[model samples]
Target: MKLATYNVNGVNGRLDVLLRWLDEASPDVVCLQELKTPDARFPLKEIEKAGYGAVWQGQKSWNGVAILGRGRKPILTRRSLPGDPDDLHSRYIEAAVEGMVIGCLYLPNGNPSPGPKFDYKLEWFERLARHAAELLALDVPVVLAGDYNVIPTALDVYKPERWAEDALFRTEVRDAYKQIVDQGWTDAIRRLNPDARIYTFWDYVRNAYGRDAGLRLDHLLLSPSVAGRLRSAGVDRHVRGWQHTSDHAPVWVELSDD
Candidate 1:
């Protein structure tokens, strides 16, 4: 099966580009983030018409997550991140598609570092770690896929020095991500293309795309059971050049059948 993750920025604004990519890539499952639309306005019909069914957690004009699959509709497993009952950001949504448990996440951007947002990011990471541990204990095939909003290492970012002060590239964020990977989950992209400077997101400002200045923020972390099936992984970089496209390109991994 082929699984992909993409931060579409805004579903409504980038609908056309999204549909085009879906048709061209035809991944078996896709985890989406940054829908930026309310549940009622999700354009479900449009997506269904493209030969996929989705389960989404959405809010107005901000963070949201969804998972789409070609055949059966995914069974929604969890909508909230478990620890914080009051946290209402539509950042996480987990579902069962086929035999795999997939988590689509839009981790907090936490900009303007050394502030409350940054603290929340760390706190959120802790919650995710707990949830991930629970899933790992189950030993079920699970794939955590989406815009983690983190740069795992210097190799994952272009001009690491320039992003050292940024929340996405800060040491704390990277360490948090490292902690998760240390839990025995496999980073699919890195596993396949370790030395390649593959990037999934580029800032809109400063002509980042034109200069190929980008970051590997979007990812797919597979549990050991699922990691054994890993076949190929890559970035759909051309999609980033589309008209009115999101700053993020799609990242995907192929796995053998169970």
Candidate 2:
């Protein structure tokens, strides 16, 4: 199966580009983030017309996620991440697609660090770790794919030293991601092409895309069962240069049939 993840930034604003990419790529399953729309205004009919069924959790103006499965309805597993009853951000959504438990996540940006936002980011990572552990226990095919909002290593960013103060590249964030991977999940993209500079997000400012200045914040983490089927992985870099495109391009991985 071909699985992909993308942070569309805003579904309404990037509908055309998104649809075009979807048609061209034809991934069997896609995880989407940053829809920035309310559930009622999600344009469900438009998506359905494109030959995919989705289960989404959305809120107004920020942080939303969804899973779209080709030729099948995605069974909603959870609309919100567990362990935080009062957290209202629409940052997580999970579904069962083609026997794989797939999770789409839009982790907090946590910019201007060394404050409450950064603290929240760490706490959220802890919660995700707990949830991920539970999924690992299932021992079934699982894929956690999305914009983690983290730069896992210095190689994953354009200028490591320049981003030391940035929340995305902070040591704490990297450590949290390391803990998750240490728990037996495979970083699909890195595993497939180690020692290569593959990036999925480029900043709109400073002509980042033109200069190939980007970060590999978006990812696909696979359980052992699913990891064994990994065939290939890549970033659709050209998508970031399209008209009215998001800061993020799509990242995808192909796996053998279960």
| Candidate 1 per-residue lDDT over residues 40-146, each given as its tens digit | 99978999999999999999999999999986689999997889999999999999999889999999999989899999999999999999999999999999999
Q: Candidate 1, clashing residue pairs? A: none
Name the regions of candidate 1 deviating beyond 4 angstroms. Answer: none
Cα RMSD, each candidate: 0.7, 0.6
* Model 2 steric clash total: 0
Position 24, candidate 2: lDDT: 94
Error of 1 at 61 (Å): 0.7
Residue 113 alpha-carbon offset, candidate 2, angstroms: 0.8
| Candidate 2 error regions (>4 Å) | none
Candidate 1 differs from the real structure by a C-alpha RMSD in angstroms, to one decimal, of 0.7
Against the reference, the lDDT scores of all candidates come to 0.95, 0.93
